[model samples]
Target: MTITHTKAMRKDNTLLAITHLSQLLHYVTGFGGFIVPLILWLASKNDVEGMDEHGKSIINFQLSMLLYILISIPAILLFGLGILSLIFVGILGFVLPIVNAVKAANGEAPSQFLTIRFIG
Candidate 1:
């Protein structure tokens, strides 16, 4: 039983090491760019020790990018000239997740890039 669990643990972490946002975001944009964050969030939620903290931090940061897109779309549509604001927010949304994911790999937690702040 213990051996089986260890094997599973190794598999999960191996997958995560390669499954960071940089690979996912570029691959998953058409599906509303939603799954990337969701998968990372779930992984983070379940990750063990060091990985768990890294996962949670990545999840939180990606969630922020999701929120930024959700909010800025309305802002851009609200008034025709909101294009500039939309462009700015859109760039941040793309950049933050990648940055946070990199930071997480190095065992650091960055500020949320989106809605709320619940993680340390």
Candidate 2:
């Protein structure tokens, strides 16, 4: 690739990585998980070639996790199974985003297992 192409690719990769990692903002803002990613995606998706796909994947994963947690809430009455599910969900929520971010940085598409495509 030409120098300009390579530079643009690097920039896109960085933006995509940020889109994936922005989910961690939730820990600080209490609700930035979705908001941060959404904003990043909206701002860059049109400009970055692969950003639309990456953005959708991140959003879908977040929404899927939210749905899982909501479902687990009622399972609290089922012998405390909800607590276990919640813990598992929390761990996945923390790990998957980081993994995806790394993949994006490497110029690889992120595949979020168990994610429901809510934005596709």
Candidate 3:
């Protein structure tokens, strides 16, 4: 006789919402936005419904924003266009998480605009 272990996944909208909202940590502490969701995703992806997809979205969005920020830094020398992009990034960074959190809480998929697919 052989025993097989099966992992059970549960639906936890609150956790998913929190994970989305966790991206705001960057604004408060200047860091941990990516790390927190990454940790939560890694810890619960196998045990939570929708965690994998939401996690990928969050990670991809964060990475995309970082890339934009990096690109903007150099564009700063080009007639201060970088400053505008930076401001846009700032606004998107602050707004998207909240919107995604609400969507997560409502059991809806995230809608992250201008996000590059880095993690899928």
Residue by residue across 11-91, what tens digits does model 1's lDDT show?
244334434454345435555345554465465555443455555555555566556566666677677545666676667
Q: Which stretch of 10 consecutive residues in model 3 shows the poorest summed lDDT? A: 111-120
Answer with 2 or 3, whichever has the higher lDDT: 3
- Candidate 2 vs 3: which has more TM-score: 3
Highest-scoring model, lDDT: 3
Ranking by lDDT: 3, 2, 1
lDDT of each: 0.53, 0.87, 0.96
Candidate 1, RMSD to the unseen true structure: 5.3
- Candidate 3 lDDT tens digits, 77-111: 99999999999999999999999999999999999
Segments of candidate 3 deviating more than 4 angstroms: 1-3
Model 2: residues >4 Å from true position, as ranges?
Answer: 1-11
Error of 3 at 106 (Å): 0.4
For every model shown, what is its TM-score relative to the native structure?
0.54, 0.88, 0.95
- Write one digit per residue (lDDT tens) for candidate 2, span 3-109: 55443532578888888888988776788899988888888776787898899999899999999999999999999999999999999998999999999999898
